[model samples]
Target chain A: MAGQPPKVDVPILKDLTIDNITENVHRINSQGSDPRLKYILERLVTHLHDFARETRLSTDEWMAGIEFLTAVGKKCTDVRQEFILLSDTLGLSLLVDSIDHPKPPSSTEGTVLGPYHTHDAHDLDLGSAISGDPSGTPLLCLCTVKATSGAPIADAKVDIWETDSKGSYDVQYSDYSGEPDGRAVIKSDKEGVFWFKAIVPVPYSIPFDGPVGKMLKVLGRHSWRPSHMHFMFEKGGFDRLITTLFLRGDPYETSDAVFGVKDSLVIELGTVSAEQAKKYGVEEGTKLLTHDFVLVTDEETRKLRDEEALKAMRKLGREGMTIINGQLVPDVD
Target chain B: MAGQPPKVDVPILKDLTIDNITENVHRINSQGSDPRLKYILERLVTHLHDFARETRLSTDEWMAGIEFLTAVGKKCTDVRQEFILLSDTLGLSLLVDSIDHPKPPSSTEGTVLGPYHTHDAHDLDLGSAISGDPSGTPLLCLCTVKATSGAPIADAKVDIWETDSKGSYDVQYSDYSGEPDGRAVIKSDKEGVFWFKAIVPVPYSIPFDGPVGKMLKVLGRHSWRPSHMHFMFEKGGFDRLITTLFLRGDPYETSDAVFGVKDSLVIELGTVSAEQAKKYGVEEGTKLLTHDFVLVTDEETRKLRDEEALKAMRKLGREGMTIINGQLVPDVD
Candidate 1:
């Protein structure tokens, strides 16, 4: 080969395209990448690559994907996280929550970790309700508790919050009533039951002012979550569950913007007789949802006792830490 | 339990600070938030958690970290990727390069895959040098290719590129003069040698204008890479090699800003004797560097040929294709 012409070095840029998703997956997987970041990246890369291949994605389209995600990150703030919403919309929220907390055989199944479970709910009277506005249909929320095996459990703590009569959570308004005031923690009474009064929830769209909303527009999809109430119940000896219950008949129930609603979670408000409704002080046609939550009893939990007042609670063998504008008291049962 | 005090329902929020690095590592090795994302996320989480613990990081500090990363993503542009630079500074670039193109026994070792290797390099004539400036030092580069058995292998293609006297790649400055023109392909002569004249290499820093620069400032680090020339070589019936040759005494020899410098890749550029300089038609004091590159030759590659190119050469098939700007060409090769 001494006198032969120099070998041709033909460019193969096409090989770098996403036409071969499996090969690209193998390339990333077989390559020496960060072991810790590998699985997530591999799955992400594979899914993304497969998506590109599926769509016959062009360079500009891939670039747009990057741009959309960047905008989502930019849209996140102290109270709002568009990236989280993007995750919620992509069903990643439910997937991540399911992976973190597997279902217990008898306890209510946990659902998507909604974006608003930021602060600890305050303990309230047995009949207190979070929504205070008077613009929507009235609803009586009956809360009951039982062991997985049907044994009654009294004094179970129930923290509940829902949208107002106008279908707006307290946090959604420009003027918040109180940071944690709308939220409440109630104790079941002597009958292993607690009850609160609130307006029936109306389905509403998630805030569409951010990049996530922009993405929804680009994908030609709606950004509304079904009407729902956030619930964080922490009883003695059970895994703390963070979940939500959607209004069964909401329009978005089937396509719950966040993929959060489950069949087991849909509760029907059995109608009470007009005479019985008058006895409790509500109209007969008014919606009243009765839900008896069952807690799994086998799980062990460590509780922190709260004092009578915030100041007393602060001094209960704990050092109070200030974060931003809020005080974080360590929960010691 | 029924008569428990109202204050007793709260659970103690312990410090709950994860302090043990080993335990964190174990946790990552055990479970990630999502099984699908676990393997990769575990490692990433491990590294991130370890980094946080190692820094004795504060909550605000951690939040700042998140914010910083968010900013990086937001700052990325269509042509610029700040996250890649972040990864470069963190030694992730070399890690990726190492895993992607593991070196063969006889080929020169590869180095960092800079963010700018966007397209295949262009080929140039043997006597042509990419240097266009008239004032920089005039130095000659000579390459000798030999098989692992010490036999010369003629007709090999050598791709080359280096920063100009001002220390900037073309893409970085977009001034063309600072770019690598005719830097991609150089063919070996009958003696298994290729040579060209240009200015001696100089140490340079990566661009520090964007979020990457900001990150370097926050971390209190510099951004200098050792002087080096990037190279990629291939021939018929042999493995393609991508590598670099570092200037032995560059300022960042030990502390390469991106941690890309390797011992085996360093080469000395000895001063040429006046007589030898004259023989090469260069002024006195001109430098001459000689690098002997050995390639690995195996039977499997010997029989291999570019199907289209070979067909074109034999006048038996459709001619090969060419691309101008990310599109197929009908006439040019």
Candidate 2:
């Protein structure tokens, strides 16, 4: 009795029925100070309650969902994130990524930032080897960064990471001594070009011993991602791009478990001649992977995203809903 | 390449657009062997994706949701279930309870079984005291159990638990030495009567130090349940009942944080005369509370539930969906 009760001025919620429960929940949550949070909570409750009502969800099923979520949370560690994996397998990660990072037709598209990225990648110079002790096929990566206006963008920071010959990241090993291997961070030169020496990435299964993996199995889905190299580009005055380059010949190219592959992001590995390989200071018959990334300026990206949002709003013209300052709100008028 | 790929014959998911992502996900998940699981998952994915798409959920917002769920999951332990608390505060618990345990009009309505109930309650005699300490107001309880068909249901197992005067269950204490206090498991006598002495149940806050508590605060809501005693009844040939009895005058009776209160479950406590208190072997001026529970037979409950399910299915008459063996499935015709 001494503690303060809820400060919300709404009438006390009582005798809730299935038909009115969603509205009552929205009323209670409307008291939040942040309009965006309130809006998101309202939509979340609507969809969640609708799901329950439509399915006639049983008590046992609800308990199973709770237990499954608990297991996923328990499976997450400093190095592993099962929740993100859940989002990825459910195709939500890609959907969010696509919505938040709309780009022009000429600009490079973005994808999901998988859970394996770390901040401790060794900073290496251009043309340096990313693999510490390579056992895979030698690969020579040649990349160029440019703006959509055909202007070379120099000094762009590029972070690269990938799995090794045995289809395992450095962090996935038991004896991982906190050293960065098969990954590096480098910047483009004045000519807007950066090349790195690395082994060809190998197709690998996600950590399939966890709850997300169990869910994929139950869904009759695989956990294998296509052989790919992760890349993140950061520069001032431009929208950041987080993407992956999938090898064209990989068996999982079309069935990437994370739904991260895009048509433009897939490229075939060309077999370089012995002379060309030697000229690049690599083995006699190295595989060459080449790509040119076109970035859109931040200002242009904002405009494009606003257009997309407006289109979506028009498509979802539900009664009583309106967009104000790009946020969905109840139309008071 | 040595491991078997997904056995399901669905085509590889490719170029998933906002308009087609839902269909692709469903197509992939349709390969699941269990029809029930497949149906549940299809609905879950549909609602989940719709929630995101309708909100145009940003990447940052998605990450925040993932983190929030992770925190909620990590907050659970052997004795505490934060997910259930989340479900309760969201009103899903009561919805599922109402759907799965439909009963006749005369039968007592069931509510949520709050997270505090424990199976370790001491099995006391029919009229023994359930409290361990003498710190709170003494009260006497008399209860009767009968079938809706007007027959007494003797020897029914009655599990009762409540918070003490300090608004804390015995298990909430750090020094809980595996002893039962303010809780008991008793059987009704031959006349379907049970009575016990206990301290007046106190209004209490749910565990608010976890993610669920933080969520409530953000929503401008309190976490208090009304002063109530939890009761679970089980008898042969009858449907099990999990419900709580609220004191009528409690301020939070109508605004129970978990939405567990119902009109039929509220009762008023009466002051007993000095002679009456002495007759019950209690101190003078003790409070007396009484209730008679009407339970439905298992067969009758099944019939009611089937009717409810049929009504719900009719209400959700979605095209291309049909009920087969009481399960929702896609109609081929």
Candidate 3:
């Protein structure tokens, strides 16, 4: 560690003011070893430095900045994260999701990973709908899986959930559930089609209990996120897409708090005859949203399938565990 | 806005298992409009992705990650930022500081900005230290501000502060006078010689009331930052440097939770006699550390002489403001 300091090392003490933040970032970019890392940090530094300069940030202001971030962390619990909400509201999550989940033409578009995607969704029969309430306008949720072309691909796992007519998802209305509301895992039938019955999703607001809410108040922005239904479409040889379907013409659709809308993901809820609703076990006159998903498969998707298999094997204990005094140990012969 | 998606844009439901985070980063590097921004964000995205993969992260874990960041934001009030601490502990602050304040062959090296540097410290006469604690060993803090080749830098601003012997900083202890604590703002004498009396700083821990502490707990790491004195040196026209004089041999130096240390920045805190201390108007029989700082000057520093001018500009129209007509309006002549 005591080698001669490089000759290029020069003292820069007298000119390292806030204004030099940009130049300093540039110098680091040119001098640092990891180009990619340097790039990202450089941009971040510029933005941060610019923010400081713009605010003419006081030491107290800076300290408060730190304190604000600290609160974001403390507010997290087993079910929610305000920081993610921060990122989500900042549009980073949607931008990232868009960048990460590029789809084939005509395929269902992806959206935000809403806060209520719990691990314990109950699996239900193909025709079973989640809404038990006899009130509210009934709607048919129908979707078909297809390849990039028009060919149907059957037996895709389609997990679906949405807010009740009251605009409350099960996770949000934890008190109102005998069985959890708005959560159901189903598989497409042999004809590559899946249908369920549920009430139309109504627009809902983002959580207002945390820092995100505080930020919204500070920024004079509303706390509402657009109405949408969460979906997870998976097949053995296709990449899993965790997405959402937005109700077309919903006022919030165009200005989703998280910026999660795409034209491809918006679908219309069409009015159906009462006779048709009765045939589908719905009360005659009702509305239905007909939607279909087309998924493209590739080598990377095959790899994901393999990984999923490995995960299943691990979960099922196909790899035998050791028994010691009636206790199961993970690493015994 | 939807005049046909860009040719490169893939559908949202296409195969999204692409393993090209790196390649995409490189592509963005050369092809992006704002090369600097592209470089920065691309690298950040890569590192973030890598961090996620390295952790074998899960949805809940990712949720936790999001929550951690959110809590960081929430913890940010007027005086704290847990995320900065997170960055500090992860070596990002030092990395940024070093990148911004590269050391020259002869000038003193710069370091990270510590947590307690918010207020615009009050200026003091030569030899008058801010804090008056008697718990730690007393020291004669002295420095000669010279150029890279040893030319004197007279009338330079030499702001300084360090913890008392009992390891408490003025800001951290109770019953503080409204004045700043453990801090002194002084100008170098005509000979570029600056000297004062103060106790050696003791190693201390970061404020432990936030998410940073929780993160440390999860990582099984200690939260102690090393013993060091804060310094901000400026001259007319020169870039201001925020740095620290670290105590060598400090147990926490190598593992300073914030990692704000450097070899050139370490100064010897030696022993001196009571008579010598008295000669310096310091109490007799107190120990002392003698050190000299070498500063470099250029057009950038010569401008720092206008610190007063800078201060004046910040105190705009406030001088004329009054509660006129029962409302807080400016007083008119």
Candidate 1 error regions (>4 Å): A1-63, A104-107, A177-182, A272-285, A297-333, B1-333
Q: Which ranking of candidates, highest DockQ first?
A: 2, 3, 1
Docking class of 3: incorrect
Residues B171-224 of candidate 3: C-alpha lDDT, one tens digit per residue: 665565556668888899999888877777887778666777775544435667
Output the lDDT of residue A240, model 1: 59
> Residues A200-266, candidate 2, lDDT per residue (tens digit)?
8888998898888888887777888889999999999998999999998788877888888888899
A128-196, model 3: which lDDT tens digit per residue?
877776665677876788776778888888888787776666666536444676788888887788888
| Candidate 3 regions with alpha-carbon error over 4 angstroms | A1-82, A86-112, A116-138, A142-227, A231-243, A246-271, A279-285, A290-333, B1-39, B53-56, B173-178, B273-275, B297-333
Correct interface contacts retained, every candidate: 0.04, 0.58, 0.12
Q: Choose 1 or 3, whichever is better by TM-score.
A: 3
Among the candidates, what TM-score does chain A have in each?
Answer: 0.69, 0.94, 0.74
TM-score of each: 0.50, 0.95, 0.60
Q: Can you write out model 1's per-residue Cα lDDT over A1-333, one digit (the tens) per residue? A: 111111222111112211332343334233233332333333334443333322222233334544665676667666666656765665445544443344555667667665565565677776666555667777877777777678777777777776665555667777775566346778888777887777777777776777766644543356666687777676677655666776767666655656677767877666756985876676787688887777654332111111122333254333432222122222222
DockQ of 2: 0.61
> Which is the winner by lDDT between candidate 1 and candidate 2?
2
Predicted candidate 2 versus true structure: per-residue lDDT over B207-291, tens digit per residue: 9899888888888788888899999999988889999999997878767888888888999998777887777787666789889
